[model samples]
Target: MPDRIRVLHVDDDPAVVEAATSALEQEHCGITVETATNVADGIERLDSEAFDCVVAGYDLPEQTGVEFLDAVRKRSPDLPFILFTSEGNEAAASDAISAGVTDYLRVDGGAEPYARLAHTVVDAVERTVDDIKHVQNTRRERAIEELHSTARAFMRATTEDAVAQITVDTARAILNMPANGVHFADGDSLYPVAWTARVEELLGTPPAFEAGESLAWQAFETGEARVHDDITSIPGRYNPETDIRSEIILPLGDHGVLLIGSCETGAFDDTDVTLARTLSVHATAALNRLDRDRQLREEREFIDQALDTLDDLFYVIDTDGSLRRWNERIPEVTGYSDEEIDEMSVSEFFPGDEHETIGAAIAETQTSGRVTVEAEILTADGERVPYEFAGTRLTDADGTTAGTVGIGRDISQRRAYERQLERKNERLDEFTSIVSHDLRNPLAVAEGNLELARTECDSDALDKVSRAHERMRALIDDLLTFARAGETATDIESVTLADIVEDCWQTVEGPRATLVVEDDRQIRADTAKLRRLLSNLVRNSVEHGSADAQTPSGHTAEHDGESITVRVGIVEDADRHGFYVADDGPGIPEDDREQVFEEGYSTGENGTGFGLKIVQRLAEVHGWTITATESEAGGARFEVTGLEPA
Candidate 1:
């Protein structure tokens, strides 16, 4: 409602038009009347200018007041129209009423009638404006509610494409803009991703905007909303020949831009911009959520792949023993489907007797942060397979114990090997008893007979017989030592290298060999096994190292050297740390280094070949490795690596 009310007064007489104008303007301060001499002139004025109400006389040059009212109804149906005529007949009043006039007034010859007409016009126009306002207010309230609904839909949208489609649809239905589209930013350009069907019908297909190509990119880069009342007047338009007269471009953060267009100029107002901005905010939030979800999904997929690649079963269990997540290996090894495993508890995979042990282990893990246990897994096919499971407790963000993450490895092959080793050890014990008791008794009787024969006849043949007996005794002792070499070490302790080397040197009968302790380091090992390993290596170096040396059976041989130096020192490298024993004697050839460790492989005639083999076996029992190489003094070197520091 404005301060001034404009009315169009149409009449056939000039005097009546002038009198009507003066009366209407003088009656109401807010009223202004413009006069037209005929119906055609009044209709022309109504089309060309804005007027609040139309006042026409019953008689005109080309048409009557009813005819003029019909013409006005075709253009502005809600505009207030009044028929003021001098002919106050029943027929004229009926026609005017039928023609949909706002009010029918008779032009009585008085200034009061004009005054009455002016008041009627003013009342009609005010009612029309009030009705229009009411409708607009109702529509605005409904639009706001619909926008709220759109926000909920955005929350449910899991993909960017879905958000784009909803944005375009919302602009068309709620904002009342049919020609709309959504453009997403891809690299250095904006591509149209979604649009309404009406948009296609109007402009076929919208063009994509490259960098600096259109106003859409400008708004997207600047994160601003732009409203173009008449796009035709704008320079550097994406489509200069396009039919769209008005456009609104809104930026959706860094994700993209939303475009709304119309064929009529100045179609969108301030309210449209405000509503569009709300929609843009919702769409941007949804897109950002979708982006984060995609990244998390990819990372989870990568972790799953890594877990599946493992040979053992990997799982995540809750505090209540329910399986929360598992790798593919679990299903493959247990012969259970993923769905079945999901419903199964952690204790259900083990036997009834083992359930208590597993529960204890899990409780310990929760307390100590880690636990390991070995139990037989009862598979779906009813087969009991031994498995060793290790678990570490998991915690939530608040540092509360959530559950356990762990791996279970099949130990069936290990169990089989252990059973085989037990059988071998039993047979070895039986053989050891035979060699110590049964063989030694007969050998002692032979030695007594040989001593008696030596007293009777002192001859060269008797010397040969004594040497043969000594060789037999040495072979039997070596056989017994080799048989028991595979036994695992039980007690582990720290021992200094220099002290062990000195003790072993005294035990070995190496009178012409000098022991050199270069660098000493403390190592963790079984004390008895480490002593045995060092004693065997020192004996081998003294007996066979020199060119001329006696065999273990007391047979003398020729040699060129009188003394050999044996060095014991630490060996440290980037990948390994341990100690080495080297002898300045005839170094083993590279071709025979690997064969020297084999049982019954020796270079000297009278040397017991089981010494080096026993050294290797003892090193392996301690989870260490030994290698034979050339020493710095052109001699044999034995390195024991992978030791645990004291």
Candidate 2:
């Protein structure tokens, strides 16, 4: 039931061809015959027409059938060739068969020879075509197997460098290329990885893509593979030599592109296009996953940095009241390690009733999805640490409470500062009240006495009363100055003791108090305080000493020379300066020397009990020490030392 098998007959002899065609044409009952007379003419017929089988004479006057079979094999190797000959010469038939001839037919025999040759040609053609198809199927299966294996290997790669290297190796193996490389685009720079032996020679530093010319842009615009058959002539392509012929670009992912190059033009065919598309789909998906993972890693690092930077104790707790997370500052605040905190409960941290309160609040926050206000906590050392804690529920995507999130700020120092401020304010109020009530009474009595004596007393009595009033007023002023000293501050400065002594000398009242300025007598002090201190010293010297007094032995009289004996002398004492107020008068007794500086303690009948006290207060304020002893002049000597040079 098969269709007719057409046969082309070629021979130099027409008799041999007719004999064979007549006998063989009817054998299959579905065979047809076409004849050519010579090898050249037979090849011409084959070129102009189609035939499944060819029958030719072994010997031809122009060319032998063996030669004709060789010619046919050059153009179509799988086409069937059969020789039909009248020559019974076995040698020529054997020669034709040896020269790649399929079969031979002898005209002396019946139609059997022709029928056997026609059936033989039909079987040969079918088997050759089947072999070609099988080879192609095997090649395709091997290519697919390699692609799947390469994809698996690529997926296991961890870093970007590893991914690029795997891509290049896989591309080279699958594409059968001599060289391959992967280039990553960063800004306008191209970074190459996994370079092969001939990579530099084939592809030098490629020119940067123009703003509008990129593999990503071209693929998006066309939604197809971007193939460059001529790298040297393509607009955005770079070719270092004429040998660099082909390139194929595939999108790797949102952020990158994959490029492949071949030395032979048209190497990337339809199969390559399909394979590349498949690879790109998987590569893009894998790359997207990697990008998401990198972003999440960076975000976590940022959060950790922020938490570590904080000074306060930050912690999180689970619904079971277990500490889950904390910062490094936790050990400084709670005296507990991360491992210890992990085992502790809410009650273990806050003691007594506060423990219950905090626990309830934490539970409430976990249940209600709200923030719990600050509550006091007890440390591991049993110290009542003042803390402000706020907790909120942590929920999952399902909006369920996961745990209690809290931030604990230690407010103990702030609370202590507030308490100190309150105490200071209370002390200031009491001090103001006392200054108004207790001190003003004594001042009022002294004022009334002076006013009464001014209108009711005579000359001698008035003079004595006026002197007393002046002393009382001076005492009041000194008291006010001492009170104000405690309330204010003075500017610290370098001062000259000689300048202070000169200023005090001009202000002394009773007698001549001279100033002695040495060449190097500069001192460091609060200038204003030093001035007040020296003025009081000079006044006391004048008030208590005599410029001209008879010696105890009365052996020496007053000096006849017209010079004041009362003089200020400056001298050095170790690292300090000593200013001595000396006079040729009676010396003070050793016992009363220390008692003179006590407030309201006086020896003179007209003394206000505040003169020496004022001097002592000023000396103490200026950080100086004053000593009273016998002077070189055999008189009262008040030496103020501890004077630092400016």
Candidate 3:
């Protein structure tokens, strides 16, 4: 803190000290001189006070100046010392010079030696001051470099702990102090968050302090840097009994504080204060960034939880439909787990018929920045499930739609019920056709016959009328029975189809026909409908392929019997087994094979075509499928497939 340098003159003669002071005082090297008359007094003065330079005489009454130089060197090795000697004592002077004295001057006459001694002291003092200034400049530059390094680290740090550590390391290195650390402000208190190894070893555990408990907290609250010059001597020092000498506590803005303790007394000055103030700005910025990062992480977690609990097939997809995010309920609704859905394309999840509609809806939503809705999707199980799909375009901060978010729920059961309803309507159309063609024809014939009977004459009229009436009654009965065959039977009866076939055979009135029946597999069907179907087929075959019948194909009929052979037998064709009515008469014409089963189409002279039509209708109504083809016996073959028991 001293602006003027202090020079001490030590000589055996008082007149010499006086002459030296007068000579050195005029030199403006910024020195204030203090005189000591002898080696003993000089030793006392050197122990008692401080000075920048010393001027001593070589030969003394009690001790030599060389010995005094040794004492000075022992006490203050860095202080500059000069020797002023008698002109005749060159031997002692040379010895003194060899012993490492700063400069030597011989007084021959007048005041020349004193003036030269003053000159020597001034030069040594100037050199010592320059050396001190150079050391201080070096220290200041190092502190600045450390601060810059710490600021870079602070900028690079991503967490509070990392920032706190950087602060502590920088404080210790820049301040050249021991027990350096950072303290965080929690409510009204400042607590140690991070500290160096010296802090733990020398300072021990940090003390807990509220708003005004410690000097550090007080300094932080007041926004003023505080210094403790000597902890061992100061009343408010952390450990007044220990060897700790000084400390500097600085505020790190509104969030925290830094504490720097030193072993040297009065160590920190204005330079440390400037450094702390600069570092606080960087610390505040780091803390602000940390707070924002924490908030963003919390927000993301909340959004994820909300999406996961939603009961729909929710997804976040890139513009190309690569999956980005998936919710928990996607698996439940779409029959695809998260692992499976991630690999699937958005179009892959839609029905073959509805894929384009969904893709268009997504494109529209992306372009318009609005939600879109689409129905119908093909599920992972290959079912056409009705879906209510909605999407929204997710935009980035630059207002470009980066992706699409969508939700969908399953409606498969509802779609299945609607399909079942459509099938029922188709059956109703079949029923209407049957009534118009089969039922109306028979009723018209009956009405015509009755009109004829009312107007006819004599005995021939009664017989002809009886014949016409009987024919009308048979046709009417057959029409009613065939009409009932089209109705769906809900009761799935597992009846033996062989019993119905045998019953139909027993009822047939073909006396000249030989009935050959063969059975193997059992069938599940309505017994009444099966009986009606078998009776119609057997009766039609008997009437159509008479014993004297000729082939439409112009091929002769071959039979093993003298009579017309009617063969009803079970045969295997692909995956289906059915009883085929085969006769050893002429086969049906190739042109009439398909038309024979169509309503109101016939091949016989007096045949009502309802027989073959009823067979096809009943087969379909029972969930069975039938086809008409030529039999091996050169007669008609009705092969009814889909006859497997449910």
Please provide, for model 1 over 618-640, each residue's C-alpha lDDT reduced to its tens digit, 9 standing for 90 to 100: 99999999999999987788999
Per-residue lDDT of model 3, residues 300-351, tens digit only: 7888788887766778889888888888776666698778888888888777
* Candidate achieving the largest TM-score: 1
Query: Order of candidates by lDDT, top first?
Result: 1, 3, 2
Judging by lDDT, tell me the better candidate of 1 and 3.
Answer: 1
TM-scores for candidates 1 onward, in order: 0.73, 0.47, 0.51
Angstrom error of the Cα, residue 333, model 2: value is 2.3
Q: Please, what is the whole-model Cα lDDT of each candidate in the order they appear?
A: 0.86, 0.67, 0.74
| Candidate 3 wrong stretches, greater than 4 Å | 1-3, 8-13, 34-166, 169-175, 193-197, 200-202, 227-242, 269-289, 312-315, 319-321, 324-354, 375-390, 405-646
Instruction: Identify the candidate with maximal lDDT.
Output: 1
lDDT of 2: 0.67
Ranking by TM-score: 1, 3, 2
The C-alpha stretches of model 1 lying farther than 4 A from their native spots are 1-141, 221-236, 263-268, 301-309, 328-348, 448-457, 460-462, 544-563, 642-646
